[model samples]
Target chain A: MSASVPTTRLQATADAFLTRFAGIKASLPGDKSLRERAAATVRSKGLPGPREEAWRYTQLRPLTDVTFETPLHADVDAQALLGRLPEIAAPHLVFVDGRFRADLSTASSMVRTGAPSFGSGARPDFDPMVALNTMLAEDGVAISVPHDVDGGTIVLASLATGQNGRAIAFHPRHSVNLADGAKLTLIEIGLGDGVYFHNPVVTVSVAHGASLTHLRLQTESEQAFVLSTVYADVASDGTYDSFQLATGGRLARAEIHATLSGPNAIAHLNAAQLLAGSQHADFTTIVSHDAPNCASRQTVKTVLTGKSRGVFQGKIEVARAAQKTDGYQMNQALLLSPDAEMDSKPQLEIYADDVKCSHGATVGELDAEQLFYLRSRGVPEAEARAMLVRAFLDEALEAITHEAGRAAMETAIAHWWDRQA
Target chain B: MLEIKGLEASIGDKQILRGIDLVVPSGEVHAVMGPNGAGKSTLGYVLSGRAGYEATAGLATFNGADLLDIEPEERAALGLFLAFQYPVELPGVGNANFLRTALNALRRARGEAEMDAPGFLKLARAEMKRLSMPDDMLKRNVNVGFSGGEKKRNEVLQMAILRPKLAILDETDSGLDIDALRIVADGVNALRGPDFSALVITHYQRLLEYIVPDRVHVLVSGRIIRSGGPELALELEANGYAGMVADAA
Candidate 1:
């Protein structure tokens, strides 16, 4: 029996959004033509509800309950908001409430960063959240890595401010273009009070032979909501390495879609989602190999405690032309509480006959043997569990090749553990 | 000093240790020799407070503290150590960090000042050299990809570093080669003094050759069948466990 697309409040939200935002779509980043196309897409697609298979495990009903206001306080100070944010010795940029803070940014001449062109473009049919973010995104950060340049750590920190009485939302658009043979590492960090929602959309274009390392640390406020989307298109022989560390927000999701469009291209999507309290976090990824001789790998680990819930939905699609494609994905979840839960769905859609695509998912609690082993060695029960959880998640964090970025992410993980303790 | 009186333990519904009575005074090393299914490992687990191995009908004490009543870490804090028969492989946890953390935990429990990195490194390096472990082992994850002999040697290295009062070694000699057995035995011997004692559990008497025990006890059907001097180990080694099993039956 086919399930019907039930009428939901999200659909009602779509109607309200179109009625309120149809004419003002030009205020969004991108060209006027692109904005027009995006406006049409939003009007046609709308926000998805639980009726959608992709969003079955996630619900946006809370969004429907409260109206999200665009907090564009242009004069929001960056220095004051930088409390507890460690200073990384590298080129960086900061954004407060999705608006860029030039006074707090440091970039080299080899990199040119700005907002997108006044153009419009359409999103893929997979994600419905992109439509909303695209419809309302502001001062998107754009980076241009010159050809053959080995760019150092380019830190991009986004702070969402919810000091206002009303519920605020920040949709920050990000665009990064890596020229041929260029190499760069990008770190995106999200931080703020949990009273807001931070919805970020990122587009990455890796040209032929280019390599980009993208690391995201989403440690937003535990009371906040974060729904992030990333789209990356890789050319021939290009490498796209991405790692996500999500340990914050009341409800958070890191959605990534990587399309291998050229031969010999590679994409690695790895993440560690650590949640406590009543937090809910999801890592959804779709790796599509449209070109022959491409390779993709994904490894995600989650640890949830209390009444928290963790979800993973990973899909690897191999098209007919993608012969000799090698795709591998693994998702492992560790539930720390009897009330805690984990839902995992790993799918492999292989149309080509000569492709090697495999995926596996596992959900479990901390290993009893390992816990006993540590405890017997004089480690307290709490410390023993913490050590084991960190070890389990460290496997996914090791995917990041950039040294400094990996350390920064580790520090963030330590902070989360400290709070849990 | 360690003492067990009318010690009975069970895993699930089946009783493993029917009734065990043994005693080892301070500074004495005692060896418990037995065949398969004689509950040698269960005795160690019961004393160390491992979950599920319940001491249902017995009184065991270490330094007059109820061994079965406290948590495993508390047992460790009271100067007890168990060199596992199978050392766990903990990937992503550095061996050095684990050792340091354990040492600091023990120190905190003792109300002694914690050892800093330099002091710990000095002690750890000397102990590792005594056990013939590579210096690079500090960089690798704890026991991950280690050979059987290496794991056993690592266990002994831990015992050497932790400086516990009483150590229970469960089949610590099962997989070690002759050279490794010698080095590991020397590591234990180096810790021998008036304040340190050991309960060595093994099937074969071969390990007794390396680390000679002051007292030897034959365990069969969960009860101590015979207790004697060092010659008892040689007797079991020569006659085998068949006679002991039949007699116990």
Candidate 2:
């Protein structure tokens, strides 16, 4: 019945992607069967359209207009690009155009590159974006920590440099595995220049009693588009805490799926999206509690100015056997301009009788009383607006316990505020 | 010095202040005592450049600057302050940050250097101690989760930090106890000198006992009907506003 509606444009884009894969599949460094299986799925299903439940707020029509090509071997100023990164005194792995550049990165023991590490945690068969990434992934980093070891911190920076007015496309596949009782802090930074398409997939597995802290900052070019998918699994007493700040890209989307498969596991999926002008950003998350006594929390905030639009879709599912489950989700948005827009959806599917689950959403502009209060105390209009915006994002920002990561996010927020003013 | 000549203002279609003529000279504090809905708060709002309180016909000047022709921040920079009866609550904005931002903004307008963090913290702590406010007040969000008296004290704390020349206390003593009244009065008095002046607007005469005023004026129906010394407040306090309202009528 659904096939009656025409999805020709989406199908054309999907077919074009499959054609691109067929031309470069042999050159790609990964399992051929994995790529072919993902290609067959794309060949039949096409990219996600507005009809898809999860893609209802986002439309992929913009991708159909531009024909993206492979990145060329253009000269890049590695030092200048490195200067734009946060000043963290730790070893970092730098990837230029989705391929690791040893000369630009500091050597680290836990880091490995040159091939795609498509871990078992991701479901390419379920998510179309993951399938797209699986079909064309080239080079990505794999970071692993042994049992009971503390890996401290590692910064994985992915940069896309598209020169000569050519719109390039790159798919990076990365994974992080923490063994039992292990701990690691992974900071992921995505930045680029010129027009490009960045499609990345990350799969994470946290063993029993382990903890993983993931902080991501995506600030791409104004002419770029980014669609990222992250899948995480946590075992007993394990914790997966992740936060991402999306302030760049013409159109961006960050989709995450976290599963608590063991008792007493914890997951926190939080984000702050700051967009202006005609930009559009979407943040979607799904937390499944498969075991009893597990807890999951989400606090997503969006600040939209100009004619920007922001979307937040969060869902929490508690299985019948997952008794004593505690889940909380909240999405709040502040529209700075009358022309700006926001759409928030919070869902709770609970089959457990003794579970505690709650979800809430709120959309509002800056409080007039708060603004007047600030201005009456001698703060200028622009400065008062910036202050209020920072305050609005403070709730979600406070959940970031990593000092350096928090500082980097704060710097990005200040820069975003500067752009608004 | 602050002067208002034949000031007439309105909110929406309803007129609040009708032809108010007042003067508050330097080195003096004057009390504008009146009952509810007598335009007491309206006068303060008008003089502070608050939005939507339209001054249909009036002229307000502070330190020789046209008060009504500028923004609220400009009025604040020109040494005009309004202590709201209900001080607003600002969540996620620390008291120290708010105070320092306001102070630095006014300082920048006056060609003064910005205050360093330690210096600002020291000054704020000293001012808080003088107001009898707990040290944690500076660390908390501005007026968030504060008691009524504590909010009033925070207002006084802001007044001390900003050090405005002309302050319009709009019923600042509405919800204060005896001790808080004394502390708030002390905060106001500490700023009293030849360079400072205040217009203390209130309904009760008790506040005037602590923050003594040089003169008292009776305002009714958007107009001042009587004027006298500080003893007038005591008279009004003993014999309520009924007599004055009837006499003015």
Candidate 3:
């Protein structure tokens, strides 16, 4: 009976989402046939539950309790939310409740709005969340960089304003394509207030000799639920560098699927999750090396205080032809309180021999000696602990190379520490 | 002034400091020389409010305030400093930032204005120069990957910057060469004045040759068995602690 509880609730949630798709299918502004197929898939499979091996550590039971409504087209004064964005000097494309707001955005020539970009990189059939996004995506951007062009920095921000105490949910489908020898730095930000569900799916394609630096900052409302999925495909001599700093959301998960389809491709998936109270966050990544001599690296750090829990699941897959693959992964968690918990799973499936693959995970409280040393230097206990926690996350945070992006991340981390202290 | 009366401390049922009594006046530097396992380091830990070393019975006062009842940071703000024997490494905390934070914390406690970053950096560089520390030392993480001598020098640098009224140096001269020893001694000597006092704990008489102490106390098995002038360190160097233990018995 206990096992059947989640199953029944999961079916109800799926039915609700399907019903939502049916109401908005005529106006969702995408491939109608594709949306129909995705809705059919959701109707059959339902939402992924605890029974699924991929989501075993992070239970979706809490999301089932909230009745999420379709976000109404209400006029939201985004001035306050705009001020909370990082002080970067780039043009921005702002989306209010997952629909593009041209008045709030600083227009960029390379970006296109008003149409959902259903790219070929994401597999809606394989992942249930991506399928849900396919069924209901209303507004997104299509960004393309020409060959050999250095398309500086651009900000993509999504703000959810749950109006009148109503729980709302939004799915934004986005796509990015970097031509050969092109470069782009994309800073994606998620911020909101009140109870809402923010589900976004992004598909990225990096052509030969191109590079894409993707930095994501997720600081949604404490009462919000965020589950985002990203699929990236890299060609020969291309690079996809990403760092996700997740410090918000009552229940959040970010899953990334990166595939290196050409030789000499590189992918770096670095993240830091700072959580407190009853917040639960999961960062899962799968790096597939399909070509010879490709390299992949991941470093995920989690700082959990109070009764919060963090999860990290990283898998490195090397195909038979992908010899000399250099893959490394490390997940570390710093549990401040005795009740805080962490779950880490590192899997490596290497069909090729002669590959250099290694992974490590460590979970510990702050070192007593380190704490004493700082306190003895006249720093108070709380400040000392915050400093030590920052130090513990330095390795993972250092992977972010963009100056403004790094500064924004530091500010977010400082705010997180401020709340904890 | 710092005074300890009938101090008895134990580490998990194993007594280390038994009925110890000592005092360092406002303008004096004293030395506590003891052999291995004689509780020299334990005394420092117990006074600095480190965890896991319990004071079963004692009354330690600093300037008429109860020291044992306060937290470590409070004691530090009260102008009490302890130079650790083995400095713990903070891998991601820069030395300059650590020093400024400590200084600002102390300043806030004392109701003084906080120093600006430029002002603090200038002051830190001057002290580091006095200790022969490179400018880049401030940029590196605190005590991480530092050589033994460099670690000792950093402790002295911290002492020089903090300028505490009373400092307890716990085996600071243990791993120093002659040159480093002189530098450390000079750093301490620069702060010696009517308002400054220190308790320099050491095992050998070598450090005393540079920074001569006003008084020397020989600790045997947890109790101070003998007390004398600077010559006591040399006497112990000649006769060894075995003779002093036998004499005390």
The lDDT leader among the candidates is: 3
Q: lDDT tens string, model 2, A71-93? A: 76554656666788998777898
After superposition of all CA atoms, the RMSD between model 3 and the true structure is: 1.4
Candidate 1 has which clashing residue pairs, if any? A30-A118, A30-A119, A31-A118, A31-A119, A34-A120, A35-A120, A194-A224
Docking quality band of candidate 3, CAPRI definitions? high
What is the number of backbone collisions in each predicted candidate, taken in the order shown?
7, 0, 0
Which regions of candidate 3 deviate over 4 angstroms?
none
Question: In model 3, how large is the Cα lDDT of residue A242?
Answer: 97
Ranking by DockQ: 3, 1, 2
Worst lDDT run of 10 residues, candidate 1 chain A, spans A116-125
Task: Give all TM-scores, in the order shown.
Answer: 0.94, 0.98, 0.98
Error of 3 at A49 (Å): 1.2
List per-model TM-scores for chain B.
0.98, 0.98, 0.99
* Model 1 CA deviation exceeding 4 Å by range: A1-6, A26-30, A72-74, A77-80, A107-126, B245-249
User: How big an interface RMSD has model 1?
Assistant: 0.7
